[model samples]
Target: MVVTDENPSAAPVTVPVAPKRRLPGWARSVLWAVGVVAVLSTASYLTGVNTLTSTNTAQIALRLALPILLAGLGGLWSERSGVINIGLEGMMILGTWGAAWGAYHGGVWAGLGAAIVFGALGGLLHAVATVTFNVNHIVSGVAINLLGLGVAKYLSTLIFQPLSGNPRQSPPVPTFDTYSATFLSDWLSGLEQQQRVGISDAAGLLNGLVTGVAPLTMIAILLVPLSYLVLWKTRFGLRLRSCGENPVAAESLGISVYRYKYVAVLISGGLAGMGGAALVLLAGGGGYLENQTNNRGYIGLAAMIFGNWRPGGLLGGAALFGYADGLRLSGGGKAVLALMYGLVLLLVVIVVVQLIRRQWLAAALGVLGAGVLYWIYWANDDLPSDLTPYTAHFVTLIVLAAASQRLRPPRADGARYQSGQR
Candidate 1:
């Protein structure tokens, strides 16, 4: 009976909760991107290899990014509706043909409209197969790809061949020479020349930003924000997203899954078509070639994944890919060499840090990464032009490997939906 009655109400032990120690993924990505850009800018200034710092490079990067951005946005819309659109390439090819036909007959504006129509047609076809008929998504996409290229080639032979005397390409299209006034272009151009005279490096970078920019470039840039607002802040977007994530639940809530999916897919096609029109406009004198798309549709898909299907994230991914492409166009300059070496140096430091922390596996991987960069640096002078286009892909692969764990696709995506199947 003398058992020490444990104080039933003994003071509750208070363990202090640890505050969040890690930065959000976006914040960390921003810091890393800023550091990389700063390093490259300094290298360009120090070496006087202005290609890396020139505004022309910036313009080229933006142009290169635009089509990818459009396609990525299209993919976002389609996939967000629980339908995978692997036929973006096919849609883009169709758009390219449409643009060529429209430009050849009328003008750039007409070409844009034609492209949208063609893309919508492709989207309708895809929806019929994947949504209405419940065909395998991947199979439908593959069939679309083959059919698109064949159709484009057939049309090219009939229309472009008869008109331009060449079946493989279309004649040049009219281009917008400048968005800014003459005075602004002159000022920026003058400042660009002064870069060699010790003016700010940014001056060179601004020279190409405004002068000779196409109207489509401006439109594409505007679409980024417009898409963000429509997809994230609007009621329709919420309903569309619900269909993708949980169609059964959405049906129970009185949402029309089929209607949303159709709209999304069509919108996706229209966006991809716009990308094709932009590509033709970007080519200007070069015009549209039989294989002008060069696999950009697939790249757009990769960008969508890299961005985790967000508009803002797609912007950054597009910029990275575009910058790499611009660098490739520069043809292995000293600035690029410096950048590669700098990356190697950073990886070496990471290896050291990992070793100090006794992270044997991580340190080994860091060593491997450093070695790869060193080899790329060693081969820079003799690197094949054919390999240049793949630099963006390499960077993307590395990023995906490092961060894919954090990415979460919409639930129920690609899953067949039947009413009351819950």
Candidate 2:
């Protein structure tokens, strides 16, 4: 019969305190590094010292960046699933050979399919070694790389031997005539035809931009968003991430960690294979070579770390590295290019180490160092040819540095399901 009236003016009911904003440390570092790179790269263009004109630079960056981005995405999946894939280069090489062989014999579609199959197989081998056999991830990865390279080289030699006579160079993959025309015209329009365009020298600039937009380059772009969706939105992705983060924990939850790890690694391989196929079909004219993948695999691994294992971030990192690669290939100060790559790798290492050690200052300094090096490279016009060997060697160093960070399996990755564990 009696209802006691609660105080009408009680302090506005506050729900239990909201959690404080906490940005991920890795994310912060990525942002900072990316920002610094963007500013420096932009400045280089404005100064006209790097020779990578604004439009051409972007095109080169995109063309170079795509394969690496794809590879990085693949690496993200495998590593996230708790399997380290050191053989990404090998997978790419194998894929390149397969694609080249298929295209030479069967056409473009066949080459692509073959590359994908080989890549998947590479992934399978990696999975078996690290997941099923519990092999040391690093050693297993190295073995895969060696195996892939040997197999590819042996097959190529067998097919194309007799040194001077029947060198196995496949015909350039056939393109729709209209496709080439349209692209060439657009490129010309962008450079020479524009009244506002500078008059100093337009021929070289036009050539560079046009060449950069290979058909495969477009495919790489499509893969970026697709990979993001696959990694974050699907059931399979959840399982893969779980396995990578804590295989044992995932196993306890009744999730088959081994199965997921196997699948993830294979998928990663498949993508890398696609990357190879793209190179051969789009860049290499359906032809196989001794080191056909051109170290793109290693570059991809670095991009993966530079991107911090996220698809978008990976894409950005890939573009940066790819631009640098393009510069090297296009006769843009090779020594400086080498130094740029080295500095980038060093920056990545420092950031990763700092994260591991919780040393923010070191990470900051590392990034600053990278920016300064890039500036110096941008400023230098006459690079030494003798340093070419050294620069070439740095490619391996870059890959190794990136792989080292990923060598140790993540704590929760590759977990296998056991009874009563879920």
Candidate 3:
């Protein structure tokens, strides 16, 4: 019940209570995703809010969610190894520069490789600072963020300015190719066009996921289960997580805590760097724009928290944030307002549950919230553009506030450790 406390970059610290599941973890994750899609399909069918399961929304969500998902996985690796990586944003910045420069000189694959290397280097620096020097993890991470941004800017001025006539941007670079599952897409598209309630909605949603999928997106998606297998099912993962739980115990068991920490943090940086690559290569008509990461690193950290620090959970979290973002970008305020209707229905459910539990005050608040949101949905044709842009952040804050209490992080996460100190 007790673990050493260290610098907390975000407020996530509650451990998760495992529930009964006959299926394997990965299988359960798939079921959960299917269930979510089913619910969304049904919701869209009933509410007549087409954006809920629209192909455009789904496609945009996948693209936007990739970076967040990658960043979250990066957080997972670092935290699971008893280190905290608050410098994910900075790492991503270095990645963008690396990807752009590499793509300019070589190709997309080359850019990916360069991004990973750049990101790993950043992780190595963090390892030296926190693991070796015992520097405060938060301070080290902040410094890295500042340094990364400055370095990227300087590099852009020197390199990209001459080529692109801009100091803060990189020239157009080759992006990863996208492929569609035409085999299924054709059938699904036919079903979707029929507009037949659940059948049509499900088809629409599925079609989005199957079409226009980029290679990096597929790789990033695969990493979710791969992370689960590596971290939850492997001996190396056990030892790495042990460092997070209790390094002293791990050391007594002949685990090299420092080596594992270094490795984990490095992998963390690599994944985050991949996120940066996603932003640069697949983020639509741009190559390493200034501040393109746009605080997604922090949001990804929030997603890790929301997911209770599990790969499947974080994937869901990232998708939720990405959906909100994509809805705003693609559907604009009309879509967001329609989305609010879904939220209102959700609150209505909460109100009923709280009422059943005899939680009078909570039920009342839920009612109030539900009523206000419903009124907004009823009155407004679209959300204000200013507020629409903040949809993802609002979702992040709401999710964290709601889910934070249920989260349980590793016991010794972020703690300063020394060999033979126990």
Candidate 4:
């Protein structure tokens, strides 16, 4: 073959490939949580702060995480199957009332069953609207929220008010007693009293965490792994996720998209309901009250977003939020205050660096950090207990705001899917 001038050189252009610079979301999440925990724990150990590492705080963190974790799992199931379920709040609210009603008549188990049923009903409504009628998923969810709350409020008047003469709250329901074995309990109690170096109230913390823990809490923790197994390791889970990612392709492949979507949504509702039941049970003999969910459903959704739609990520997100909540609920002592100030100083240094780098957003956050420091300083001696409960919300907001671009959802998640339409 004769080579012509138009033939050019026989060489392939080599564009340099960029190295993989971003870490996996799960690894980043785990590292972030561990770093925070390490920082707090080390501060406590070195300074004898005794603030964040107490048994009471650990127990509270678990208690706070259970509901959010359950709800986040529920959302994962539904959204992973191509349905956007914004009605989780309404479903959870119904679950609370159902739990109270069932406990009032039958028992705690019955209450749990009732909560599931109520949540399932809400899910059914959502499925019918979004899956069958082809209604907008967001609208359907909003309607469910309104309807669920109204139904619960009206039913409370007839069922709960007769018992307590207060339509807004139900009478005390039977609660699960704390589990404490004679030998284990005594040994742990004794261990707590005798502290060792580097451990510092570790026994007491462990005892507080395991003892008196509600059965539902254990179930919630177990569900984390169960969710991971079912969603990531099973054939059924793969099919369900396929439907969410591309329902048309799934339908072409003989997968029943409708069936998977229905199953996912129903399971989602049940999880949210269970979360409500767990919350009431965690209250320890206290009955359900109006608006008892306290926007936890929304918080759970935030956690699902934070977790990047994975079970392991969900666990980390739940723990981070739960720890913040626990801190808020249990105000710290002088040592804790010192640690807080130290953290503030660290934050201020970072913000100042950012300001020097001329990042406008960092400058704004710097102002906010300075405000926080001023507030802490103005408190004089003690930590501001009343404002603590909002730390979880604040942290959640900051994370979401900062990392919104990194978060992605299933492509076909909220789209209407009609067979053969794709």
- Highest lDDT, which number? 3
Model 4 per-residue lDDT tens digits across residues 278-316: 777665435788988878887888899988888887887
Ranking by lDDT: 3, 4, 1, 2
Taking the tens digit of each residue's C-alpha lDDT, what string does model 2 give over 1-422? 23333776555554566689988856975776555444444444344444443445545555556667777877888888877778898888888888877776787778888989998898899888887777877788789889999888777777755432444444345421113346664666555434332431243344544554655666677787787787789987787787778666777777887788788899999999987876777642446667766778877887777666777767667766765665555545643454364456557766888879987876887777677767766666666666543443354465455445544435654333333444
Candidate number with the higher lDDT (2 or 3) = 3
> For model 3, what is the C-alpha lDDT against the true structure?
0.88
Best of the two (2, 4) by lDDT: 4
Candidate lDDT scores, in order, read 0.79, 0.67, 0.88, 0.79
lDDT of 1 by residue, 1-422 (tens): 12333787665556667787998756977786656556556666654566776777777777888888898888999999999999999999998889877876788888888989998899899988988888888899888878888889998898788777999887777644446556876877777777553344555555666766788888888988898788789999899999889898899999989999999999999988888887886644336688888888888887888888888778778887777777767646454565566667667767888899999998898889878877877776645666666777776777677558668778877877665677
User: Model 3 over residues 1-422: C-alpha lDDT tens digits?
Assistant: 23344856555567667877688867987876676666666667666678888888889999999999999999999999989899999999899889898888898988988888888888899999999999999999899889889989999999999999999898899998889999899999999989887788778878989999988999999999999999999999999999999999999999999999999999999999999999988849358888989999899999999998899899999999999999888778887877777777677778888989999998898888878888988898777877988899999998898786699999998899999988
Query: lDDT score, residue 208, model 4?
Result: 60
> Which candidate, 1 or 3, has the higher lDDT?
3
| Reference-based TM-score, model 1 | 0.86
lDDT of 2: 0.67
**Candidate 1 regions off by >4 Å?**
1-8, 11-33, 45-48, 181-203, 283-286, 333-336, 345-364
